[model samples]
Target: MKNVITISRQYGSGGREIGKKLADKLGIPFYDNELINLAAKESGFCASVFENAENKATNSLLYSIAMGMNAYGNQELGFTNLSLDDRIYLAQSDVIRKVAQKGPCVIVGRCADYVLKDTPGVINVFIWADIDFRIKRVMESDNLTEAKVIERIQKIDKGRANYYNYHSSEKWGRAENYHLSLRSDFIGIDSCADCIKSYIEYANNK
Candidate 1:
C-alpha cells in the first residue's frame, strides 16, 4: 500500500495549505473537509450533522476526570447505545481508514493521526505556530479584529484538542505522537511542506 500522511494542526497554522502542497508535490490526493462528504456518503448521515458534531467539543466531565490528563468524552456506551455524535465520530473514523487504504494521500485534521494510529506506512505530522503568528494569519484571511481572531484561535484549537483527546488514547499535537513536527510560522508554510516531502522521500527510501 502507498504511504499515508496525516496532519494534526493548530488553528490558523496553515496546515491545510501545507498538506495540499505536499500532496500536490507528491502527486497524491489530499483530504480536509472532504472527509465529511465522504463519511456522510459512507455512513448515510447528512454532511451538516458531521459538521456540527465536528465543531462542538465534548462536555463529558466524568470522562475527563476518569481519563486524568485531558478532557475526554464518555465511552460507557457501546456502539449500538452510543449517542449520535459518537456514532458520527466512528463513521468518520472508518472513512479516514478507508481512504488511507485506497492509496497515498495527505489528510488534514479531524483527528486522522489518531484514527490511523495502528495503520502501517502512515506518517503522522503535527503543524503549529507561535500564537502571534497564528493570530496575524487568521486576521489576513478572516477579516476579524485581532481580539476576535485570538478568541477564534483559542476556541477552535481547544475544541480540536478536546475532541482528539476525548476520542484518542494519545494527546493531540504531542510531539512524540507525531513522526514529524513542523513549526510553519518559523520555516514558512511552503518550506514546511517541502520539509515533509523530504522526510517522506527519506522514509520511503531508507
Candidate 2:
C-alpha cells in the first residue's frame, strides 16, 4: 500500500506551502482546502460551514449540555442535537479517511495525522517556525500590520492547537506527537520538502 503523509502545522508556519511542495515533488495529490470542498460535496453541506470549522473547535459546551438534557417534555428539543462545529468536523473527518484510502497524498492540517493514525505506513509531520519568522510570514503574506499579524497569528495558532488537542488526544505541535518536526525557518520550503521525501524513501525501504 502507498504511504500516507499527514502534516499538522502551526499558523503562518509555511506548513501548507511545504505540503504542497512536497506533494508536487512526490507526484501525489495535495489535500488542504481541497478537503473542505470534498467534505462539502460529500456531506451536502455548505462549504462555508466546513471552512468556518476548519481549524476551530466548538466553544458551546452549554449547547451540548442542553442537548443532552431530557428534562423537557419536548423531544425535539433534545433529539439528535450536535453542535454545528461537531457536525462539520465529523463530516470532514469522514472525508479525510475516505481520501486517505484512495492512495498516497500530502494532507495538511485538519487533524489528519490523528485521523489516519491507525493506518500502517502513515508518516506524521509537524511544521513550525520561530515566532518572529511566523509573524513576518503572516505580515508579508497577509499584508497586515505587525500588531495585527501578531494578533491573528496567535488567535489562529490557538484555534489549531485547541482543535487538535481536543480531537486528537495528543498535543499539537509537540515533538512527541509527530514522527518528524521540521523547522521551516532553518530550511526553506523546497528544501524541507526534499528532506521529507528522503525520509519517506528511507522509511519505505525499511
Candidate 3:
C-alpha cells in the first residue's frame, strides 16, 4: 500500500483497466490521462499540448541520459531552451514524480516506470497479451474490423515503444526493467490486478 505502481503496457492490452481496478481495490489514486491535466496546471502548458507531444515524431533530440530525476533536471538546464515536445515531456515527468512522492498511486503508461526508476517503494509492471487477444480487445473497444484493429494496435504499440525508448534508459517491455510482468491473455484482467496486489503484499512483507 505504500508503493507506487507504475504500469507499462502494450497497446490493446487491458493494462489501463487493470491499473484502475488495482487502484480501486487498494483505495489509492489512479493516474493515466489525469497526469496531463496535473502537468498542465503545474507547468502552464495546455493539456492538449502534452497529448499532442506523444504523437510528434522525434529523431534523437529528446533523448538524454535517462537517469530518472537528475537526468531530466540536467537536460539543457534552461527550460526555455528545450523544444516544446521535450518541455511537455519533462513537465509530465515532473508531475509523475511529484504524485509518486506524495503517496501510493497506480500510474498507467507514459514511461512512468523509467521516470521513477530510482525511487524506492516503487513497483514497475509491464502488461502484455498475445496478438489475437489484443486485436480482439481493440476491436471490441474501438468497434473496428479485425484488420483495422490490427493496424491500430501496431501503430499505437510502435508509438508507445518509441516514446518509452526515447525517454528511458531501459528498453520497453524488457522483463528485467520491471519488478513484475503479466500476460493479460492468460490471466484475466481482474485476476492480473489481484495477482499484482498479491505480489506487492508478499514482496513488501518480505
Q: Can you tell me which runs of candidate 1 are displaced by over 4 Å?
A: 58-78
lDDT of 3 at 135: 92
All models: lDDT? 0.83, 0.80, 0.83
- Which pairs clash inside model 1? none
Give each prediction's root-mean-square deviation over alpha carbons.
Answer: 3.5, 4.5, 3.5
> lDDT-based ranking, best first?
1, 3, 2
Q: Show model 3 residue runs off by greater than 4 Å.
A: 55-76
Model 1 Cα shift for residue 176 (angstroms): 0.9
In the range 70-92, model 1's lDDT, one tens digit per residue, is: 22234434454466766788889
**Model 2 pairs whose backbones collide:** none
- Tens-digit per-residue lDDT, 120-198, candidate 2: 8789999999999999898988899999998787767777777776666587878988888999889888888988888
Score candidate 3 by TM-score against the native.
0.89
Q: After superposition, how far is residue 202 of candidate 2 from its true place, in Å?
A: 0.9
lDDT of 1 at 37: 90
lDDT at residue 147 of model 2 (Cα atoms): 94
